[model samples]
Target: MRVVIAKCSVDYAGRLNAHLPLATRLLMLKGDGSVLIHSDGGSYKPLNWMSPPCSVSDVEVEQDQADAGITEIWKVVHHKTADMLVINIHEIFSDASHELGVDPGLIKDGVEAHLQKLLAEHIETLGEGYQLVRREYFTAIGPVDILARDENGGHVAVELKRRGDIDGVEQLTRYLELMNRDPLLAPVQGVFAAQEIKPQARTLAEDRGIRCVVLDYDALRGMADHNALF
Candidate 1:
């Protein structure tokens, strides 16, 4: 990964047009060929970012651009979408690179771990014909909580959370993206399961064609009646 602190202006073309005026910002050139531009604030989110499967190259600056204090230009073009992110650099304050080895991935808490086990034992909770493939099914990115197959033999990836949020939805989406790339799991579906799901999380999950399932912890544990009204 390479990090650069520079005074630059940004322009994005394709799908939409956006411009960021000249300012001092942090530019990240990731190992996966993604580029991100970030300001001093906004927490973890970059002000603008281009995801992986893209190429970045140094491009020549126009005479007028050079006259306006631009020293260099970096062009990022998406491989699939053809979206382009242009960075006009006036000055680079700092530039550095780091070699980050393979990530171990996030560890789930005790409750989530237990929930995964319960769901695996009762995979049919997802649907009548669902059968568990395995728990913690490993992928290049991370492990999905549960991998199952529907009645029609379609692959399904389940992401479990104690309280479902947008982040959880996004995580599952990444897992699904990677899993579906494999010929074996070309059509893997996603199930976001939690004890309680937030409205925003449900909306996003459904929008992405991922199913949302609310788990009854006690019932799954066989401690509560399934037919109880209260």
Candidate 2:
């Protein structure tokens, strides 16, 4: 990981045009070829970012840029989308790189963990003709809660939560974005399932075309009672 604190201006050109005037900000370059520009605020969310399958290069600054107090130029380009994020540096406060090895990944809360297992076992509770493909469906970003096929054989990615919120919706959104890019799952859909869902989360999920499902823990466990009868 490379971290740099610098006074820079950012310009993004792709699906939309955006600009960040000159200011001191934190820049993170990860080994995965992703770049993020963050400010002192906004918590963990980056002000601007270029996801993986991208490249970053330090290019020579133009004469006019040099005259305008620009000391360096970094260009980040997405391989697939051809989107570009350019940063013009006026000065760098600090620059350092660290070798953080493999990560263990995220640990789910106990109830959340069980939710995934139960949802996978009773996959059809989502709807008739739903079939579970697998749990913890692997993607480059992270593991999706569950991957299944609908009646028409279309792929569906389910993200389970104990209490659905906006962050869960965003997480599912990222999964859908990455999964849909794969030729094998080009038309992947998403389901945000939880014991309770916030209105904001449901709104966001629906706006993104993701279906929301409220699970009944007791009912799900009731279905498991056949084992006791046996």
Candidate 3:
């Protein structure tokens, strides 16, 4: 995803970039006074840009304008491509808060704790001998969300996504490669767990001796009923 900052002051550019996802590609257009963001299947057009003392909503309006305009134009430019935009007004607000000397680390910590709790609870229920291991660590290709272990002493790596067209098969392949490298982890198997699994990914897993497990909100609720160790 490309995060386009238009007409932004030099002082704010670095601050804005810091809040973006590390994987996001950043583009800066100084003195243009407009912001445009482009991502999978959508684009955000140039919108209003104003300095501090502006209400959060006003800043969001500018972002929305950029998103709307850019997305429409992107669709026209590349009809075959998917151009999508996700505007987070709070991100700008957070930057402002940081500039004002407010510590946002507490809020971030709270959010992380909450998510970790959810993951721990669900993973614990996966079976009798499973445990939550590392999280957001790099494997062979990139960072994986979670790496778990079964009681039988097998390793399992898992990727979590709220939404997206991910290549789970290739992703799992990389995890398997990394796991096999570790003498202790070589005996473990790899599993791809998502809200939904693509057919191609499933086929790829089967061919490579990996397992693909789909788990949604509802599925998670009943996941413990099955004996995973067997």
Best by TM-score: 2
lDDT of 1 by residue, 1-230 (tens): 99999999999997668899999999999886778889998655567777667899999888998999999999999787788999999999999999997777777788888888888988898999999989988763457889999999999999999999999998898788656655567699999999999999999999999999999988887732443436
- Stretches of candidate 3 above 4 Å error? 1-117, 162-166, 218-230
Tens digits of lDDT, candidate 2, 9-123: 9999976678999999999998878788999996556788777788999999889989999999999998987889999999999999999999887799888887788888889
Clash count of each predicted structure: 0, 0, 15
lDDT of 2: 0.89
Q: Model 1, residue 93: what's the lDDT?
A: 93
Count steric clashes of candidate 3. Answer: 15
Mark the regions of model 2 whose C-alpha exceeds 4 Å error after superposition: 129-134, 137-143, 147-155, 173-189, 207-209, 224-230
* Candidate models: Cα lDDT each: 0.86, 0.89, 0.45
Worst 10-residue lDDT window, candidate 3 = 72-81
lDDT of 2 at 229: 90
